[model samples]
Target: MKTILITGASRGIGRAIASKFASGNKIILTGRNKPMLNDTAEYVKKNGGEPVIIEADLSNPQNVLSLTKSIDITQLDLLVNNAGIAVVEPLAEMTLENWQKTFDVNVTAPFLLIQQLHSIMPKGATIVNIASIASKEGFPNWSSYCMSKFALDGFTKSIREELREKDIRVINIYPGAVATDIWNSVPGEQNLSEMMSPESVAELIYTSVAQPSGTVIEDIILRNLHDF
Candidate 1:
């Protein structure tokens, strides 16, 4: 069974991805929500996969290093950097703390994970970052979120080439407004019904990662018919 490390696995796309990849695999689920993580673990176990829940608040750098300690694997077949936060504050009203918080989880944590786990990711391993459409396009009141994703896009692009030399694949999945609880906290009314379901995104991610080692699905943009 392949070992897959998935951040943000407590819910949303992360939880869906864990279930999609659960059958006959070892899933390492990490997220801040302990109860939700347990629920995901149960789903994974029932679906015929081994699940290990590692509770970590990606916003905290200390917890990022502790994640490495709990992961017991010679090689990580897949790493999904999906834990991220979005604070909908206009640029003029935004505070440095919020911007720093966004970077801590969205950018810094991923960087640290890749660095800490680099040695264990041998050739053919895949790293997928759950970026957003905002990564490429700027959205009003989403300055901090957009900026972090853009930085993530750049970081992943640079490493994609670096990892290419070692035959390891790095992919960035840019998803449009997905129907996840993440949007619930963004303030204002969100048209969740028009958005793509977490399962849809998870299925696509599973499909891409399942491709043969010789081929790599570098980037994907997932969105529903209606762009949010």
Candidate 2:
């Protein structure tokens, strides 16, 4: 069984991805929510996968380092950097604390994880970053979110080349407005029904990473049929 690690696996696209790959694999799930992480662990167990749930505050660099201790001896096959946060407000009103928090989870945490876990991730391993369309285009009040994702975009691109010789593929997925809880607390009402489900996004991510060893889907943008 492949050893797969998914951050933010407690819910949304991360949870959906866990369900998709749960048939037979070692899924390492990490997030801040213990109860919800346990629920995801149950799903993995019931579906025939070995599940290891580690509660982590990814915003903390020290916590990211501690995750290496819990990883198994086997090489990590896939690393899904899916944990992220956003502070939605006018740019002028966005606090420094919120801005730093956004980048801490979205960009810094993933960088630290990849750095710490680099030794265990053997050649041919895939790293998937769940970015958003905002990474490419800016929204009125999503400056902090967009900026963080944009940084992730550049990080993935640079690493994609750096890891090329090692045959370690880094795929970046830019999915448009997924119907996730992340959007629920936003100020205005949204057409959640018109948004793409986290399941579909998870399917694509799994498919991209599941490609044959030599093949790599470098960058992809996923969007719903109807624009909101």
Candidate 3:
């Protein structure tokens, strides 16, 4: 069975992706919430996948390093950089700490993790970064979040080229606003019913990863039909 590692797999899109892959693969889940991670592990078990849950705060450099050491990266078939954080505030109101924290989780952690794991990754391994439309557009009161995703997109492009010789596929998924707990941190009313469901995004990811070895689905953009 293919071994897949998904960060922030305790909830939302990450959890949905785990469920999609659980019936056939070994899923390694990482998140800061031990209890929530356990819940995801239980779901994976129920779905017939072997689950390995690791509680990690991606913002911590040491934790990122430890995670790589804990996993058998050489045997991994997929790595999903799905962990991220955001701070929604007017540019002037944004704090330095918040901005740094957002980048630490969304950009820096992924960079460090990939740097450590890529060397050991098999030639056909795939790396998927779960980015957002914010990576391509600037949004008011979302400067920190936008910047982090932009950095992530840039990183994905660079690595895709660098790993081309190794035959490792790097995919960046730019999804529109999805109904998740992330919106709880943003101060405003949102049309939850209008947002895309996490399951749709998960299915999109699974489809991209399942493509034949000779083909690569480089990028995918998913938006709610009603949003247009």
lDDT per prediction? Answer: 0.92, 0.89, 0.91
Against the true structure, candidate 3 reaches a TM-score of 0.97
* Residue range 1-228, candidate 1, lDDT tens digits: 999999999999999999999999999999988999999999999999999988888998988998887787898989999998999988899999999999999999999999888788878889999999999999899999999999999999998998898888998999998888989779798888888999999988988988999899999998787665
Which candidate do you rate higher for TM-score, 1 or 2?
Answer: 1
Kindly report the root-mean-square deviation of model 3 from the true structure over all alpha carbons.
1.0
Report per-prediction Cα RMSD to one decimal: 1.0, 1.1, 1.0
> What TM-score do all the candidates reach, one by one?
0.97, 0.97, 0.97
Each model's total of backbone clashes: 0, 0, 0
Residue 204 in model 2: shift from native, Å?
A: 0.3
Candidate 3 whole-model C-alpha lDDT, 0 to 1: 0.91
Candidate 3's residue-wise lDDT over 1-228, tens digit each? 888999999998999999988997899999999988999999899989999998889988888989889885457789999998879999888999999999999998899888988877787889999999999999999999999999999998999999889889999999999998899899989878889999999999989988886678998889988786
* Candidate 2 Cα RMSD after full superposition onto the native fold (Å): 1.1
Candidate 2 lDDT: 0.89
Off by over 4 Å in 3: none
How many Å off is the CA of 159 in candidate 3? 0.6
